[model samples]
Structures are given as structure tokens and as C-alpha cells.
Target chain A: MTAPSAVGISRTTRPLAPPRRTRRGSRLRYTLTVLAFLLPSALPLLAFTIYPMIGAFWTSLHSWNLIGVMEWVGLENYTTLLTDDATRRVFANTLYYVVGYLPLVYIGGLALALALNSLIPARNLLRGIYFLPVVTSWIVVALVWRWLLNPSVGVVNAMLGGLGIDGPGWWTDPYWAMPSIILASAWKDLGFVMIILLAGLQAIPTDVQEAAMIDGAGRFRRLLNITLPLLSPSTFFVVVISLINGFQVFDQVYAMTGGGPAGSSTVVVQQIYDLTFRYSSAGEASALSWLLFLLVLAVTVIQLIGQRRWVTYA
Target chain B: MPERIRRILLTAVVALGALVMFFPFAWTVSTSLSPGVGLDATPQLIPDDPTLAAYRELFANTPFARVIANSLGLAITTTALQLTTSSLAGYAFSRLAFPGRGLVFGLYLATMMIPIQVLIVPLFVQMRSLGLVDTYLGVLLPGVASAFGVFLLRQAMNSVPRELDEAATIDGAGHFRIFARLVLPLVGPALASLAVFAFMSSWNGFLWPLIILRSEHLQTLPLALAGLQGQYTTQWDVMMAGSVVSVLPMLALYLFAQKYVIQGVAGTGLK
Candidate 1:
């Protein structure tokens, strides 16, 4: 009887162990299925994004024209870019654009968002109207702005003249070239900023606003105290995105001014393109790109750290 | 200010701002329609002698039509590829249980911060080495795999009920079948939102195309438009006409799918 019972237990345990093995096999099958699903994106991302990123850094270390053999010159490209006055000016120009663009676009967006958030007739229509530029390509906007700000034949100065004010040579003037870029950039991006801020505004509970109202908080005071503090996340987003984009400003510069008027408006990206394609200095271009990558990464990290002091999650 | 007065004042200001914002577009259309070449001192809101001469000249003389077709074809292909890749990866990340999923998804997210400017040099080298320079595939391939699309779709897919997938699994449905038949239909809005973004980004893409496609016939709209401006700096009407042609399709798409576009943008920041 004891032998028979032991045999019965062994038989039951054998079936259970095999089932466990089957479960393990199924897990392996699941992983294979997952790989199949991810293959389309993973292959491209590895080939395009991941590999290129590493390749960029590697290429930065080597001096090579697109056509010629790569010569390993460790850190030489980076050193040249650092000491080069023209490259220095390009980075400064990019920073200047960010400094000018961030505030104008953010403020303009905040204004529009606040207005749209209010009770207004044709709200969507008004929002869409303001957002017209956001949908158009930079080239189209840049072209329009070139004509609109044409020193002689453009409508902008023409209108300014009608208002008893003389408008300066916009894209032509070295002093105004970056400002001109900022203006067009701000114009195009305001709608995007507005949409972000509007979403932020709407997320704030009305009860919070009403509570402030019941506490006798004035409209301006509520906005400054209650609204803005709560809206910091979106504001931060607008700033960070605007900064990153401002650094990469190219299409407008390419189409509108071509980084012209003595290279006053030449930014990092324009320099990168010219260095590679125009000048056939791929190593320097890669080096410059990595520098920009560092700049953007540093700024974004700073913003993220700084947000902890001001951004209220709730 | 009184409530009524404040409301009226706000309305007036908002309306004025809207007009200011819309003025450039109105001016572009008017300039394109105007008969003469350069702009006048004061822009004509409505051109006195409105004609389609610039449009006619643009389509007839230049490769504008071919450029448009190239742009349209490339954008469609890019968008389609992006959707397929993104949705599949999104389903894997959100629904499928697999080892190392978190790490892989983290990689996907991290790539979003790496701007294209950083990668362009190496990418161009890769394309050249592959002998894909001046090809449509060169312009189309790099943009087809979008990290943001995957992230967005994953977010959308996550909200889908797990019970549905489990029930399908119990009913002997495979992951692919469940993904296509069940999860996908539920995430239609996200797919649309991603589609709009993909299309817009591809259509507006300039830098890669500018670098990759050296041939005149291969030029996308933005590249061709930039070239048009370079060649005909004084031809405001034709430039504006090219501008109009470049901008109209996007505007029409935006108007038709305004909600999806706005949702895509708004969703991004909040995320």
C-alpha cells in the first residue's frame, strides 16, 4: 500500500513539473512574440538613431570629408570649434535668439491663452486664427516674413512709415537680423505655447479660482499668485522647448537671411550645415553638433532641476 | 472696469489680436493674387487686380508641381511607416509581457531628447555610403521611425482595459490578432493624432531633404520653395504663390482635423 501511494504521488508530481516546463516555454514564446512586434521600430531606431548617435561622437573624433578617408584627430575638431571666433559668434547668436525668443513667445502665448480661457464668442475660431502660423512650414513663414520685412519693398516698414515711425532695415541690418528671426519665430510659435498654457489653465480647478475669489483675491493678484504658480509646469515646458528649438534655428535663417548681413544671425545649426556640406568639414560639423547636444542637454537638465523649486505638481 | 465694459474690452482686444495674427496669411494670399511683381508700400488686403497669374507661372514654368508630388508622396509614405512601426512597438510596450521591456522602452524615450541636428552628419554619411543620396527612400527612411509616436501610442494603449486582452488570450487569440483586432480599434484617436503630426513633420521637413536630395526633381516643397526664393527674390507674386501652394494643403488638413492636431500638441506638453 505504501509503495502504491508513493507511485501515485510521483505520477501527480511528474504532470505538475511538465506543466511548469510548458509555462517556461510559453514565456519564451511570449518574448519572441514581443520581439516580433518591436522589430519594425527597434531595427530602424538602432540603425538610424542609436547607431548614428554613437557614430556622430566617433565621427567627431576623426577628421574626414564625406568623400575622403577618416583621419583620427582626437579632440582636435572640438578644440578648433572652441577657439574659432566665428563658431563662438554662431553659438552666441543662437543663445541670443533663445534669450529674445523665449520671453516674447511665452508672454504672447500666455496673453492669448488667458484671453481664450475667458468667456469669449467664437473662441475656437479666435484660437484657430491666432494659430494660423503654427501649421505653416518655417520656409513659408520665413519667405512671407522676408517680404513683410523687406527693407525697401516690404509691407512692415511701409506700415511703420504710415504710423510716423521709421522701421530699421530688418533682416539686412546685422543688429536686427537676430531680432527679425526672433520675431518670426515668436509669431509662429505663440499658438503652440498658447495651447500648452491653455491646457495648463484649464487643468486648474475652478474651485481653486473661486476660493481665491471668495478670499477677495483680485484678478491680477489671483493670476500672479494662484494661477501662475499652478501653471509653472506648462510655463517650464514652453521655456525648455522654446530654448531647444531656438538653438536649432535654421530654416528661417536659411530661407530669410541665409545667416547673412556679415553672419550676424548665423546660429549653431547653420554653421553645422555649412561646415559639413558647404565646406566639406564633416569632422568639425560633428564636433559642433556634439557641442550643441551638450549645450541643449545642460540647459534642459538645469531647467528640470530648477523646476523643483517652483513647479507644483498638484 | 465694469463687468460689461471689461467683457467688451476683452472681446475687442482679442479680436484685434486675431486680426494681427491672421494679417500675414491674408497678405500672402493677396500678394499672390495681385498682378504686379513687388509689394506696394501699403499691402492691399484685397488686391484690386486679383489674378492667378503667379500660380499659373509657378505651375507652368518651374518644377513646383513635381515638387508638390514628391512632398505628398514622401509625407504619405513616412506617415504610413511611422504609424505601423509606432503602433506595433506601442502595443508591445503597453500590452505584451516580456523581459527587458522597461529597459527598451526607456531607450526609446531617451532618443527623443537627441535632436536630429546631432545625428544628421552621420546619417548623411550612412546614406551616402549606402548610395541612397538623391533618392526618395533616403528622405523617407530616417523620419519613418518616430520615438514620440511610440510614446504617445503607448500612453493611449495603456488606458485600454487589460481584461479585453486577457479575454482574447483565453479565447486562443494570438498577440498579433489581439493587437490588430482589439487594441488598435480602441486607440484610433491616438493613431489619428500621431498621423497628423507625422504628416505635418514630414511635409515640413527641410534639413534632411535639403542635404540628401541633390537633384532638382527630388526636391520637396520646402526645398523647392527655398530655391524659388533664391532664384526669384524680386518675384514676390510667384514666391507668394509658391508659399500659398506649400501652405494650403496643411491649412486644409488642419481645419479638417483641427481637433486631432490640437489634441496632439496639447497632449505632448501635458505629458
Candidate 2:
């Protein structure tokens, strides 16, 4: 009953079909109805996602700009990106982002979750206040941070100046630009992680904490041994997500640094944008895009494999 | 005695953290209201002389009003499209007897794993070939078909009792009849949850829209805000005014539907 599919449909084959056989004359109608429902998503998904995935590979092998003649240059794009010093620095900058970005989000989110989990007045209000940033678009977040960190007349440096300390030029200074983006990114996203962790915290039964308390475990000890161990699954979830997001960071860098005062904050996606649109290097950009995808895929695969050692599912 | 002191310290720390979280936004609003006195050290939080001159100038200088309308129209269109398609695909996956169900769904979920960064250039080529560049249709198409939304709805649809659909089938009711009548009504809560997510993502989506929408008048809030920032790099007051305008609707929506939004997020992320 399975025909060779032209489009990207599921090639599901049962050795002996039951439903189609039973339906008989109405089988075609049933299939049609299913296709009707499926086609809406399937066509667009194939067009937008599946088609482009294949096209990405094909395009990566050709030296083509948007308007110019397409020339076959398989592996050259990859070679250029891998060997070029500038592109190498772009990869390093991406690594720097993930390295600096994830920890701040995890630590800050966990701390906020832990704090909110405890007895507190205006708890929901406080949670809402904390979550306010999460919903704000990254463009807005980047703009806000740019203003706040604008050295000459910004609020942050002004506060630092008031404290009798000179503040460094945040987004302008190559050294501080990435760290500044990390802080802003973490702040904007920490609320989502906090909410997820808070859900985990809530799921941990109060009796477990009580049992630990009655067994002569102090607050810190309980948190270290019992609380954190139980919170592993959620923590693992948050970490994986944080890493993925941290690696693919584009908006903040695009808005705040524009790959910046000597390319300090140039993340991979930013480079891809610059390559594709600015430099009109579609083939090289696609290659870079795939490499970024590979890095994310590799990291995620590694996390999945490694989580077996530490992440307790139950 | 120490426990009390610990609570006090924890409370103080959390409060300070909240201030840090909120200070930028508060200052944005404050700045948006204040006229451009030009840049100076230690800008006033209360803006001793508050004015809406920045807000006025934001509208007067650019197509800020048209940008807002564009954002609203696109967000609503994308949300509607996603909901309909996701719910339909979700229903077929959950209730229908289909071959390769496992394989197809697996492929669909894997798309979620791939970051959108990978798709930008090739997707752009496809759009350009289709002659849809710099159009709302191009911006709306990519986001409207979401695999995660389908997966979420399928799970929601699974909890729906099969007996009801079976009875309907026995009553000679078709898939559409059962789906449109029985299944959808039962899955209202799930639909609502997905709507909030779909709406927010479309509204806040920056990268794809920024790539596709080249024209200024076609720009959504996020893109317009980006353009606005590019134009007025040093006009903190007007930029803040635009920032305030862009962020307020979302903040209000989240507050209005706080429980649904949070629960929706928690459900998706935890799963």
C-alpha cells in the first residue's frame, strides 16, 4: 500500500495493514483526509525547513552570490573558513560566549529559584518582576544594555563613578564587550531558567526536606545532598537549553556590538549574517552556518551521551 | 536567631537582584518620558522635568505607527496559521492510524533541535526564487509551520479519550466531524496555552524577519526597534521611547495572562 513518496512524507510500512484493508473503498478517502490535514504543515515545513536543509548543502558547495553567477567550489568554502585566521577568531568568540554565558544563567537562575522557593512576601509579584526581562525582545534588551553601559553618560558608569570607581567602557571596549553581552543575555533569559527550576523545586516534596531536617541535616547539607540531587533532571534540562541558546546568540551581538571594535564579540551567527548579506558570500555563509549547526549538534550529542553519567532520570 | 538573620539576608539579596533586573526597564521608561537634555553623567531616574517629547519625536521621525501595525498584523497572522496547522497535524498524529508515525514525528522533532541560524541563507534563496523577498508573506511562512507546536498539541490530543472518537465513528461521523466537534472542544486549554506561546514567539522573533523584511515600512517592532537604534545610535531618549513602546504590550500581555503564559512555558520546557 506504500507508494514511493515524491514529497517528504513518512514512509511508514506495516508488513500487513489492517486499517486500509478494512476500509476498502473508503481507503482513498481516508488517506485524502489525512493528507489534507498533513499537507498544511508538511508543505510549508518541506518548503521552509526540509527544502532549505538540502539547498544549504548544495549552496555550500557552490560559490554563489545572490545576483552573480554560481560556480562549483566544493570544500573550498569549508577549507577557507577552517584555515582563515579571522574565521578562526569567530569560532573562538563563539566558544567564549558559551563558556561565559551558560554558567551565569545557571547560577543566577538557580539562586533566584532557590530564593523564590523560600518563604517570602510578594512572591508572585517578585517572580513577575524577575520574569519581566524574559518576555522583552533581545533587540530591546541589547538597546537597553547599550544605553545602560554607554560609558560617557550611561547609568551604570554613573553609579560606578558615584562609588568612587571608574567604570570601563562596556560595549565599546573589546575586552568588556562580550562579557557585557553575556551579563545582559543571562539577565534577559535567567527568568525562563528560574521558572523551570522553580517548577523543579516545587515538585520536590516538602516531606523530603523535613526528613533531611529531622535526620540532623542542616539547611546547607540538605541543599547539597538532597535538594541538588533531586533537581538534577531540571538542572540538566536548563543547562542543555542554555548551552544551545548561548552558542546561537545573534541578536544581542547584532544590536549591541555589531561584531565589534576589533571583532571581540563576533559570534558565529553574526559572522554568517555578515558573510551572507554584507559580504555577499552565500556559499561561505552556508558553510559557516552548517559548521555552527555541527558545533551545536556535537555539543548536544555530547551532553546527551555524558548525561548518562550524572543525570538521573527518575 | 541565625535563621531569622539568614532570611533577612536572603530577602535583601533577592530584593537587590530584582532591582538590578528591573533598573534598566525603569530607566528606559524614565528616559522615554524625559526630553533629550543630551548625554550627561548620572541621568535622572525621575527625569526632574518629565516630557513625552521623545515619544512624540519617535512617531514624528519614522514610520513607528505603521511598524506597530505591521507587527500586530504579522503576529496575529502567524499565530492563527500555526494554531490551525499544529492542531490539524497534531490531531492526525494522535488519532489517525498512520504508517511511519514514529519516524515522521522523530524527523519533525529533530527540526526543533536544529537552530534557525542554519536555515537563514538557504531559506533566503528559496524566498528570493519564489519572488517573495521583503514581503509579509515571506516573513510569515517560515514561523507558521512549527514542529514543536505540532508535538505539543499531539501530546495534548493523546490525553483525549479514544472512546469518544470511536463512538463518533460508529455514529458514521468522519475524522473532520469528530475533530472539529469533539476533539477540539476538549483541547481548549491546550490550544490556549499554545496560542500564548505561538503569539509571543512570532511577536518577539527578530532574526528571520530582520533577514526577510528589507523595507522600513514592512519592519516589525523588533526590526523597527533595531532600525531605530541604528538610526539614532546616540539618541538614548528617543530609543528609550521606542524601547518602552515595544516592550509594554508584551509586558502587559504576560501580566494579563500570567498564569497561562507561565504554565505554558513550564509545561513545554519541563517536557
Candidate 1, A115-209: lDDT as tens digits: 89999889999988887788899999999998889998788987888899999999999999889989998899889999999999988899999
Task: Give lDDT: candidate 1, residue B262.
Answer: 88
Give the distance in Å from residue A302's predicted Cα in candidate 2 to where it truly belongs: 0.7
Q: For each candidate, what's the DockQ?
A: 0.57, 0.60
lDDT of each: 0.88, 0.85
DockQ computed for model 1 against the true two-chain complex using alpha carbons: 0.57
TM-scores vs. true structure, each candidate: 0.95, 0.95
Clashes of each: 0, 1
